[model samples]
Structure formats: structure tokens, C-alpha cells
Target: MRNSSPPLEVGIARWIEVMRRNLLLASIVALGVFGIAAVVIAKLPNVYRAETRILVNPQRISDKYVSSTVSMGPAERLNTLSQQILSTSRLEAITTELNLYPKERQALGRDRVIDLMRHHITIDLKQSSDGPSAFTISYTGGSAQEVATVTNRLAASFIDWNLRDREQEAQGTTLFLEKELATSKSELDALEERLRVYKVQHLGQLPNELDANLQTLSRLQVQLQANSDAQNRLDQQALLSRSGSYDASGEQGENPQAGLRSQLVARDVQAHRDLAELHSHYTAAHPDVISKEAEVASLDAQLTQTPASVSSRTRRSGSVASPADAQETSIHHSRDHLAAEQRQIESSINNYQSRVNGVPIREQEISQLLRDYDTAKEHYRSLLEKTYTAQMSMELERGQEGGSFTLLDPAQVPDAPIGPNRPVLYSMFLVASLVAGLLVIALRERLDSTVKSDGELHDILPHIPVLGLIPRISKTIVNRSPAQPTLRRAS
Candidate 1:
């Protein structure tokens, strides 16, 4: 079998010969492809991009004292602004105002024009360790001036929109707080009115007056005690006077001492009745009940002592006699005087006891009213404070002291176009054309299967061997040779 692989040097020589044979065709193809690329590159339009830089500045006031209500970060805010600025309506407005994409508008209508304009716009956010967050707004157009104008307009619109949005947010918050404050104030007023009415309805029963009520109760109790003691002393005096001896005969039926005793007994009965009435209203532990018991005991002791002292006096005066008629008349007058004194004392005691009994009831009622009033007052105060804070925050936003975007760099008309890079396009086209030319040469070389060298001839017919060889010569070289001498003889 014949070896199919040729030596490297022989293969290289064979390729060189093939290239030389096809040199003219390869050069023509390469030049044609390069020409087409140049024409296509020259016809493409240039695109110019203009950019504006915006810095997201921190709030003027420290956040430690007053924080900004706008909580969005630079990237998020940029995205939101981008959506708003690039919306259909906004882009349409920009397109109409700037006379942008006029040909596209005519060819594809308003929506397509707006879409094209949106496609031309771009936003990019930039952040650095040492500086605040910033972003760039850029627009591309066929003309440098138009691109710059559109970019600047978009930037200005964003700034205006941001300011307006912030102010509106602040004003809206303020308005809402104002309404809440009004509602809270109304509620507070209603509570105050209700409290006032409650206090009026239960005048003496408020908690704040508990101490004073206790003090008055104590004073009244003391007064009631004093009056009881005086009534008891009078009763004792009347009892002692009544205990004195009296003659049965030649006596007017009314004994002076006896009338006085009768009057004292009636006053004692009235006191017992008043005590029973007090028991129905108050417990035994109550001061009024205790005082009444002490008075009753004192009156009983006075009555018991008076009878013994009278018995002793009667025994000592056994030998003495007196007219009974004069005694009886004097007794009647004395008894009337005692009765009047007893009635006055009883009235004073009753008045004091009533005052003491009423104090605790009044205190409990007043306490409830005061508690409700205090609760309402506290709520009102809290709402007032919150309203004040809301007002301050609104004012801060109105003053434009919160986080905001500042135009760091305005868009300027570019001196040069940013796109339709002719050099790069030309380079790419050059490479593509060279590759096509090479591919065409390789395809032509592959299709032409004729033997061109000794190694190829050997591969085609390895069984045959040749002793003599005929060398090939160019037709031009053969024709250029001098003619043989036979031509001269014929002439």
C-alpha cells in the first residue's frame, strides 16, 4: 500500500504553489469584500449621547434629631424616577416638545415614536465609599444638540417632580394630622364637658375633695359630741333637782323638781328616737352611733346618781316643811326652760351627724368623676404633642430640608458623536471580508482536484513508475522563443 501522508516540507511547497496559481483571484475577492464594507460603514448614521449627573444629598438636618420621611435609597429612587420619566405619557410629551423621532413618528405612529424615545434614554446609578450616592441620566440621538437638550429637560423634570412630590407628601401629612387634631380636640372637649357635668351632678362626691371631706366630717363629729355632752349635763341637773323630797299633802300636783324631771325624761326619749333613726342609716362602728351610745350611758348614770342623792337629802330634811303651791309654779317655769335648751342641743347634734354621714358618699362620687377627667386630659395632652411633632415635620419638608436630589452636572452638547463607531465597524468588516475571501479561495482550491505536484501524482498512481519525465512550461515563455532558421531559408 502507498503511504498517504506527505512530508511537511513537500505539503508546504504544494500549498505555496496553489496560492501562487490563484493569487489574482484571491486579490480580486479581498478587494471586492473590503469595498463593500467601506460603503456600508460610510452610510451608517452617527449617534450622540448626552448625560446629566445628579447627587442624592443627605438631609440638611441631622437624622438623629429629625429623620427624612423619604426612605428610598439612591438605586431604588432612581428606578422609580426612571419609570416615571420613561412612562408612555412622559416620553410622548418629551418627544413632542423636542421634535424627536419625527421620521419614526411618521413611519410608525405616536406610540412607536414614544417607544423609540424611551429606548434612547438610559439611567445609571453610581456609588462611592467617600462620596454620596449619585446617578446619571443620559439620552442618545442623531444630533449632539438634540441629545443634550433632551437629557437636560429630563433631568430638570425629575428635579421638579421630586420637589413637587415631596412637598405634596408633606402637605398631605400635615392636612391629615390637622384633621386628626381637630377630631381629637373635639373628643377632648366632649370629654371635658361630660366631666364638668358629672362633677356638677355629684358636687360633694369628688375624689380630690376627699381629704377636706374627712376633715369636715371629723369636725362635725366633734361638734356633735360636744352638743351631746351639754344635753347630758342638763339632764343630770334636772334629774338631781327632781330627786328632792316633797310633801304629799297641801301640795299642788305639779312639784317643781318633778316637772323638771318630766321634761328631762321627754328629752331623753327624743334622744333615743334619734339614735334609732341613726342606727337605720349607719353601722355601730360609725362615730355618730358611738357618740349616741355614750350620751345614753351618761344620762342613765346621772339618773341613777340623782335618786340616791335625793334619798339621802330627804332623810336629812325630815324635820323641815314648805308651801307646795309656790314650789309647783316655780317648777313649771323651770321645766319649760330645760325643755327649750334640750331641743336646741338635739337640733345641733342632728345637723352635725348628717354632715358626717354624707362625706364618704360624696368623696366616692367625686373620685370617679375626677378619674375620668384626668384620663381625658392625659389623652388630649398626648394628641397635642403628636400634632405638634407632625406640624414640625411638615414644615421641615416644606422647607426642602429633607433628602433631595441636586443637579451635580447638567447635560452639555457633545462635541463628538458617541456611537456608530466607524473605525470599529470598519475593523470588524475588514476581518469578516478577509475571512470570506479566504473561505472562497479554500473552496475553489478544494473543488479543483487535478494533480499539481510529484507527491500528488504519486498518491494518485503509486503502482506506475516512470524512467523519463516531461516538464511543463508556460505558454507565454514557449511563444516568446526565437523562431528556428527554417523561417529565413523559406524567405
Candidate 2:
């Protein structure tokens, strides 16, 4: 035969009766637990937290003209700064200065003290929509004033560290650029000197002189041609006058006649040659040819004016005629002068030709030197500009005009402790005590398996039927003396 389970309402009613019977014991246990919890909570130390807010300010200057040297963002910079500030040395210093963790330092030594201090320091970054990133630096301590002081000090330290870091970076960059500028300037100066010396050494062969050289060469060539033509005409005229007829073939012999007529004919041939040479080198209206023609006409007039009888008389005497001798001497002197002039013109032509031929070579060499010089100059100028910018950046950093930290909210002394919340502790103690009381009652019930109700009995024996029901007598009534002699019987 299977046993039947008790009904839900009957089980609940039986459990309520069992709890009523055990109420005194449960209350004793609950009160004891509550007392212990209260004592433990009271013994815990209170911890106060103080916080300060700092803003990461952007640079005052625009990035377009002068850029900031500090490139790290607020988040990255905060991480780095947290590491540095929380380092053992820094934390130890802070601990010593603030007189923090006296008991912990004594129990766990200085290293643990520093570690504990670092653990208590918190850095939380908060970014805003319109402003730069702001961060909160908070520290937990036993005393509110001490916590506030420590937090403020830490914030100040961060500000100082940021300033020193940025200034050092900016100054270092400036120094580096200054050194580079010096080197560039030196190089530029050296190149300038090299170019100057090269120009001096190769005076006529510089790229800048190319046009002037070409013009000079052209003019010299023209003068050379004119001089050569004049010389040739003079030679031809001398030959023609001596021979007394022009030779188209350029073949002529000296005249044997020794008189004024010979000299006159020589002079006339010279003049015609000069005019022809002028026509070859220039236009028909040349000044030199016109002047020579006029002289030639004057000479012809003098020749015609001389009497033929006078010449015959002189020829008969066979003595050298005075006027004819003078004429011959003059003609020889003029020829010598022409020869010297031609030699000078030839020398000038050779000089000009040599200069013209060397132009391309000089141009190539000068172009190479100038190319190098120009490159150096450009590099020097660029470095100079950067040097100026670096100097300005350094100054800006020194002035604290670049990205920096500003204390937005100074650390304040907290009025209340942040930890060991009393109300929450009391509430938790009450809940825990209630749960403990319920567990104890449940444990006792489980240990004692005897049936306490009719329903439990029914569950144990479903086929059995109750024959009778007896009322339980109270212990108080049985222990009491008989209503005693008051005895309703005697009454």
C-alpha cells in the first residue's frame, strides 16, 4: 500500500503550529546573531573619499600656424600620468608627506604601504561634448581632510609633471632644430663661397655670362670680318696702283717707275681697294670708304697739278726728285700702318672665337655648381623657418600657453564617510538573522522525524482509519493543586 501526501493547506497549518512552538528559541538565536553582526560592523574602520576634477585645456594658438609639440591625447596622457604618479617612489613620497597608513606601514612594511596607497588612488576620465576631456582624481583615506589634501597634492603633481614634460619636449625640439639650422647655414655659406670662388677662377665662363659672351663674340666676329676685308682691299689696291691696272685675278707685280706718278697711281689703287672692301663688309655709305675716297680725289688733284715738264726735267737729271721721294715715303708709311691695324684685328678675332667656343662647357659646369648651391639654399631656408617655429613652440610651452591641465574642481573635505555604511549594515544584519533563525528551525524539524499532526499520520497510514480522538490536557492544569478545597463540593 502507498502512503498519501498531506494537503497543501494542512502542511502549511502544521508548519505554522511548529513555528509557534519554537518561537522563543528562534528569537534567542536571531537576537544573538544580530548582536554579533552589530559588534563586527561597529569595529570596521570608516574610509572617506575625496575627489578633484582637472580639465585638459586645448592650446591657445591655432594649429594652422604653430602646432603643438605634445601629440598625446588626454586619455593616453592620463594613462601615462597615472603610471608615473602611482609609481612606488611617488606613492611612497606621498605616503610619507601625508602620514598615511601608519598601522599598515608598520605591519606590512613600506613597500606594502606604497602599494596600498597606489591602490587607493583612482583616476577616472570624463569626456564632454563641448569641452576638453576632464578627469577626476580621488583618494580614499581614514580622514576626510587628509584625503582631500592628498588628492589636491596629486592633482598639483600631475599639473607640474605635465608642464615640465611639455616644456622639456618643446625645448629639446627647439635645440635640435637650432643645431640643424646652424649646420644648414654653414653649408649654405660654404656653397656660396664655393660658387663665388668658382666664378672668380673661371671669370669668363659662368652660366650668367652666357648671353653677354654670345653678344660680344658676335660683335667681335663682325669686326673681324670688316677688318679682314679692309686689309685685303688695301693689299689689292697697293698691288693695282704699283701695276697701274686693277687685277681681277689677284695677280700683280711691283711697278718699276720711280716718280710722283707711280706714287699717285699707288694711292689711287689703295683708295679703290678700300672702297671695294668697305662694300664687301658694309653698305655703300660707309664712313671709312667715303673719307678715303675724298682723300684719294685730293691726291689726284695734286698729281694732275704737277707739270709734265718738271717730271721730265727731273728724269733727265737722273737725280731722285724731292717731291716724288716724299710721296714714296708717305705711301710706305701708310702701308705699314695698315699692316699693324690688320694684325690687331686678327688678334681680337681669335680671342672672341675662343670665348664663343668655350661657352657650352662653361655653361654645363656653372649649371652643376648652381644646382648644388640652390639645393643647399633651399634646405637652409627651410631649416631656418622650422627653427623659428620651434623657438616659438618652446616659448609657448614656457608660458604655459599650450595644452595644459586646469583644476576645475578642487578637492574638498568630505562630510561623511564613504565606506562602512551603518544603515545598510544594520539592514543586512536583520535579514541575515531572520534567515539564520529560519534555517535553525528547519534543521531541528528535519532532525526530529516524528509526526506532529493528524495529516502526517494519515500520510503515514492511508488505509488506517481513526477510531477515536483524545483531547490533550494542558500541563498547567495538571500541575495546579486541585481547585482545592474550594471545592465546588463543599460549596
Candidate 3:
């Protein structure tokens, strides 16, 4: 509080007074900032965002493995496939359809507005912590309604496109499987027809699995033929035995060797030849008669001792120890030989019949095999029919193009301005004002310099002559319109 204060305070007095002339510079800075901000706010267009949502569901359709002849259904493979479809070229194609690009401002035909348009358009896919079962897709743009419209259109279009693609695939698959089914059916039909004809020709015979049956039948037939042959041999022996009494000249009853034997049995030979001695010595019905009877008994006993199935006459007449018995014995010997040959043939026929009894079981097995073949053929035919039906459905679906994706929602008018963020604008203005105030103070310090009073001027250049000096300007500067009075004199 000394009267002179410090020398430093006096030195800064002129600088402080010069710093106060800051009005004009502040006005200039304010006007410039305000003009630029107003132009930026007026030219900028408003942008708006809109959104839409939908749910997609899947369904089931099969027995064990869900066999399909055409393209498989969506529900069968939706999860992984749907995601792949979403992020594919199919989605990019939408951009082409929508013509989403900016308009240019240059003389060149190129568009600068396209860059701004890109900034306006935004596509976002939202996932949740829950699961991958569902997701959301959103789009934002210059207008809220346009965003909603595009989202819905894209969603519908993608669905229709997916359907069309499936239909085409189905048709292709159907055609391929159909050809196979047709060929298989043709082959099956041919086989069945041939089998039918074979059965008809063979009469109750099934061709499939018939080798075993045919073999068994052949063996039976052979056995029957052998039995017939054996029977024929037996018959021939029987006929030969019966015909032993006949001569070889085809006569029914004549025996050439029987002549002498007949004579030996004849009453005249016995009476005339053997009676010569008897007539000389004995009367009829006396000792001679008894002796003749004894002789007849002994010859009959010899005939009875031979086999009944053979010719006893031959055995008994073959050798009468005397010459009187010789001629009749030869006929009996031939009869006995024929009877033995007949017995041998009969034994052979019996042995053959015993060896032929194992042929019915094999025939039954062959019949069963034929049944199995028929069943398999039926199954093959059924599959062929189903495949054909599927092919037809696929073809129909393929023919239909340009499916759904209809306009559920279209573009709409926007309501609010989207640019020139207000809080940021005001904040910028406040900062500009502070900077302008500081700059004005600095500029005024350079423009105003005074050495008016005695003490202040003597502070520096004290030896210079002090003439009557101009006083420092202490009057308050009032801001006014340019048309008003203003002080222009130098200090």
C-alpha cells in the first residue's frame, strides 16, 4: 500500500488498458461462426430409421428315416441351411433390385450422393444369449418407413427365392429318381412276365428256385422206368414158363418130346408090352394086379417129391432106372428149368421197388422258394410306383417361378429432422465465444500504446523532453450501430 506501489505494477498499467479494446474483433468472430453453422444446418437432410420382425417355424414329415425321392423338405434341414442362405449372394441380389446408391454432385456423371446414401443405410443382424434357434435382422435408412419397407420386402423375397430354389432341386431329383424307378419297374415287369409264361408252359411249375424240384422229378421218373423194366422181365419169364408145353413151330399145344412119354403112360402100351409076361403067369385082379398097382404108386411118389413151382413131370419122367422111363423124363426136365428162371425174375423186381422212395420233400422246398420270389417282386413294384408319383409332384413345383415376396409394407414419409445435433451446436458456440474473448484481449494490447502523463512516460525514456502530452483514453466504449457517432481521433 505504499503510495508509489511496486515498479512492476506501474510497468503493466499501459498493457492492461490496451487489452480492453476487444469489441470489434469479438463481433467479427461471432458473425463468421454463426454464418457457417446456419448454412450447414439448412442444407443437411433429415434421416429416419424403421424396423419389422417376423417368426419362422419348422415342421416334421416322415416315418423311420424320412425317405424322399425329390428334394428334401425345409423342416428336415432348416437350421444350418437357413443361416447359409441368409449370408449368400441371394441377399446381395436385393441391392441390385433396390438401386441403392448415392447421387453425384460433380460434373462427371458419377454420384457423390451415393457415399452419403451409404451412410444413411445400415443393416444389422441381432443375436441373443438365448440360442441360435431364432435371430433378428434390422435396417436403418434416410426414412424410417423405407427401412421397414426394405426389411419386410427382403424377408419375403428371400423366402420366395428359397422356395423356388427348392422346387427346382426337387424337379431335378425327381427326374433322376424317376428314371431309375422306371428302369427298375421295367426290369421287374419283364421278369414277372417271363416267369408267368414259364409257369404256364411247365404246368404248375414255378421257374424261380426250380432247380431242386426239377432234379427231384428227374430222379423219380428214372426210378419208375427201371421198375417197369423189371416188371417186364418178370412177365417174360412167366410167359416162357407157361409156354413150356408148346413146340417151337407156334403150335398151341403140341410137344415133340412128349410122344414117347405118352406111350409109356398109355393103356395099350402098358397092356400090350408089359402084359406079355403078366398074361403068361397071372389072372386079372390077382397077385399080378397088386404088383402093377405098387409100381404105379412108386412112380407117382417120385413126381410128388419134385418142386411144385417146377414141372414135376419132367423130374419124374427124366430117369426111370429102366429104358421104359427115359422118353417121358425129358419133358419134365425142360419144365423145371423154365420154372427156376421165373422165380429169379420175380426177386429182381422186388429189389428195385425198395430203392425208390425219397422224392417229395425236395419238391415242397422248391415251391416255397417260388413264393418268396413273388413277394420280392411285389415290393419292388410298390417302390417304383411311389417314385413315379414323387417325380410328377416335383415337376409341377419346378414349373412355377417368381413366387412370394409381395409388398407387405412400402415406403413412408418421415417426420423429424435428423441432422445438426443441438447439444453439440450450443457447446461449440460457447467454446467459440470464450476463444474470441481471449483473442480480442490479446489484439487490443498490441493496438493501444500510450505515454501521456509525466510519471508514466518517465518510467522509460525519462531524459526525452516532456512536451504537453495527450491523455490516455479512459472513456467507456459503448457498442452502437455503425450509423451512430463513433470517436475516430488518435490519442
- CA-lDDT, candidates in order: 0.69, 0.75, 0.47
As for candidate 1, its clashing pairs are 205-362, 205-366, 206-366, 207-366, 207-367, 256-331
Better of 2 and 3 by lDDT: 2
Report the lDDT of model 1 for residue 393.
66
Highest-scoring model, lDDT: 2
Q: Over 4 Å off in model 3, which ranges? A: 1-19, 60-102, 105-121, 126-152, 162-180, 183-414, 418-420, 429-491
Name every residue pair that clashes in candidate 2: none
Q: Evaluate model 3: give its TM-score.
A: 0.45
- Global local distance difference test of model 2: 0.75
Encode model 3's per-residue lDDT on 260-325: one tens digit a residue: 333333432233224223422333345774576466455445434532222344455564342312
Q: Write the per-residue lDDT of candidate 1 for residues 1-491, one digit (tens) a residue.
A: 12544577667877788878888887788889989889988987889999999888777888667655555665666677778878999888888877888888878978777777878888877878854488889998999899889999999988877777776766776677678778877877887787788778756556565566556655544544454455445445544444333333312253344444555565674575566456445545679978987886676566545432233323446845333333534654654564565455445445545545666786676577667778777877776776676667667877878767899999999999977889998888888877777788799988989876666777788777745455775666657767634544654
- Tell me the TM-score of model 1: 0.71
Q: lDDT tens digits, residues 205-278, model 2?
A: 66667678768766755665565555555555544443332132122232223345556655765665565455
Residue 276, candidate 3: alpha-carbon lDDT: 29
Better of 1 and 3 by TM-score: 1
